[model samples]
Target: MALDQLDGELEDQEESSEELYEQHSFKIDGGQEPLRIDKFLVARIEYATRNKVQKAIDAGRVLVNGKTTQSNYKIKPADEIIVYSHYEKRGERIEPQPLPLQIEYEDADLLIINKPAGLVVHPGSGNPDGTLVNGVAWYLQQQNPEISEETLPRFGLVHRIDKNTSGLMVMAKTDQAVTSLAKQFFNHTVYRRYIALVWGDPAEDEGTIIAHIGRHKRFRKLYDAYPEGEYGKDAITHYTVLERFGYVALIECRLETGRTHQIRVHMQHIGHPLFNDDFYGGDRIVKGTVYTKYKQFIENCFAICPRHALHAKSLGFLHPTSGQQMRFDSELPADMDQLIEKWRRYVKAKGDLIVESK
Candidate 1:
């Protein structure tokens, strides 16, 4: 269907509200024919959801050439469009709460953090506060009152890690830094390494996994390797075994290409899935006579870390301004450390038993 038709459908569904509202104006330039309003909005606006765009269209909240049109409405070059939106005024401010943040390195360009496990990087649907972003904003403001809303570092975020994954992350302080760092990421020049504890030891000590990843057709939230070219992107991971328990192995993975959940998904593609990843959906426990000595420890560790056992261990990139190469590292969080220690003890105990039997 044509783009304007989609806009009409979107406009038909909007519900009117009595709350105070605001209006913003936009102009379309240098186009042959009218373009779909929704498509145009998505391109022009940052952080706008589909639902939000549709709602505005339906409410007759958007105008094309001074006339209300559907979300799919077409517009010509130089057409004037005004959008009525209900948004919190910009002058209102939110106070940042005091939260603990692990600062690894900091400079005028960016802040490097050893983000702890169990901490959300930013606020979202279920988490509105106590995020790494909030903490960073608070810390900056306290350090310099000059870092006001207008001057605040856009939090210059470059990348992300899962809430349960502990690791090194870089945040930009200046617009130039944000732009340069983003280019490095897009060019795949940023080097990232992660440490993961997975079930089972692979036959080979080191190997690479190359697969295309996309949303699972059956399950909406989880991602899986595409089976037959429906939806997926190229991903590459290289892993080397650091240590081995009776059943589990500690592996370090370097990313030649990074995709969402790349380490966990690629590890699962090999016979060894991460220790406790319910979303990938594995048997709750790995029970075998061969793993008897270490089974209890493994189960306990997995239970304690309900999320996947992956840590972003290191990050490397070129300084955006200085043109110097820099690298940062983060130690495994306490929980992961404890799990590794317990596994070591189990292996030692099992060895002692075997010697006694001999």
Candidate 2:
């Protein structure tokens, strides 16, 4: 699957994130006859037409034995199959699961949440349960037993951040709210500011990154910033260096267009990727010293903030019904705070030798 598929839609989010992909896995019976993959899938999968199956195969959503398969490929006995789709599938529903959530604000129209890193926003094939959606469903249902998971609008989510990127998020509680909030995000009127600890000091105090972003051609899990604009969707991110530590820097990113991995990819395009961001090549010492002590310090910093050092520090949007602009801000999670502090002390102590390795 393309990273764009996993990135989740950035706009017009009235469509639930779960609806972006439908997944089904099957193991062929031992006595099954050899048949074209598409026909085989169509016959076994409910509500799936031959046309739809063939289209999925053509789009590389159908996999046989863990590899993308063409429609003409004959499925032999004991073949393993998996299919993904942008449409709905039968019997798919979010099973409410109780989870610890930090809700900053809540009301009839919408709610603001400070999502922690490591928590997925919604459920997918890899994560069938234990998602924000599951917890929210349980929370909402606790108040109103009549609410149905299948019928809830967008599962009440207006927008989403990446799983490992901690930050604030807004969710609508009603269909009317869904339409209003989704339009705000789609129109690019929503305000969102993120804090990122990236490798290297940016030459400029502030700059804008304008590029086209899409999934990497080779690595589907990572995105690529296309400076030439030959592929992908247009994206823009404005960033300001909040502090400098010689080897690395603390930066604030204001997103103009929220493409998937927008800040991470754009920063890398400009030679600065977020610290400890394994996906975009920030896990290693991109900058700083190769000396044993410096390496140890960086390794300790990694242990302090293990995930990508990005946080959605603030979010703003107009109230769905009242037109009152609602904005929320969050403190950096403990890990990032400690990581930054360690860098602050390190830079102060060894200012002259900080960039020795770079």
Candidate 3:
């Protein structure tokens, strides 16, 4: 809810290149007694001091039952609450250095990269150096020796994946590329797909999740699905199961509308969470047996991945300069690829433990 602290500890990149993001929702119990929303929230929300709640209210980011409410408004039972802030802040200055990059495709107007897991896309407060941005800037400097991070109008990233999520990213290299590609993202014409290993299989082999995602009221960094489209922007995700391991499922997600953490939130809303996604309560085992050996195996899996099992496996969009359609695919990073293999072996050894795959 608070931008200062969110689902993850990432600093804001350049302000002009950044967009405000929301990821945190709450619902009051029917029998709850009246209490000042801010006071009530402070007591209920973890790490949410009274001062922070008051400020969110003052900023008009606090909502009650789908309407903006002040800090002092007495909350009623069944009243849904939500808070929001810019996903990150422009907290620090950015400079360039010769950081490494895994280039996939590059042209005069844009660059496609196979970003590794744990790589921050840009310079932010917690990650002030050695980011993909820094690396790209350095690469650009080698060619022109005149362009620098400060001189660049924007970071050139049309969109971003999370720091822990691995996959393909296409960043713009020129002003024309920025405007054209950004428009594609805004128009929801950019085709994006993600691969994830989640805790459980879905009820359907394929389905769409359409919900208004907003910030979690209690957990400031997490999100909740508002089915009524109340608190946040509309988001749509379609998913199809590719494989199932009794306790987990490997699925593909197609984004029709891109929002922060869209796939993660939708999967969670459907009772499945991405494996090892610590922010959304996926670090612990959500499925599987209670046996010590199974528990140890899960813990081992966590150790292997250490981060959420998600990857931006594919992207397709029109070329900004040529207006020609472009598409790219990437192999899963080592951690996720190996994690799936581990599950595959476990399922095979367990025989009947196998869940039917779609």
**lDDT per residue as tens, model 3, 160-236:** 78888899988777645655676577668888889999997677888999998766656655667888987766788
lDDT of 1 by residue, 1-358 (tens): 1111112211121221111123467877785466687877766665555666766576455678877789777767888887654322222333466889888899988899998778986655466678887888788778776664344323555566777788888887764565567556745788898988888766777888877776666765666775344567667788888887756788899987666667777777776888777766433564335366446665677766667778899999999889999998878877778877777777787673211100
Model 1 RMSD in Å is 10.9
Model 3 weakest 10-residue run by lDDT = 11-20
Minimum summed lDDT over a 10-residue window in model 2 is located at: 10-19
* Ten contiguous residues with the weakest lDDT in model 1: 10-19
Model number with the top lDDT: 2
Q: Global lDDT for candidate 2?
A: 0.78
So what's the TM-score on candidate 3? 0.74
The sequence of per-residue lDDT tens digits that candidate 2 reaches over residues 1-358 is: 2211323332322223211333577899889888888777777776667776665566455778978778899988889987654332234567888898899999998879899999998766677789897899888888788776434443676577888999999877865566567656755788999999999888988899999888788876678888889878778899998888888988999988767788899999999999999999999999966999989999999999989999999999999899998889999999999998898788778754433212
lDDT at residue 112 of model 3 (Cα atoms): 95
Clashing pairs in 2: none
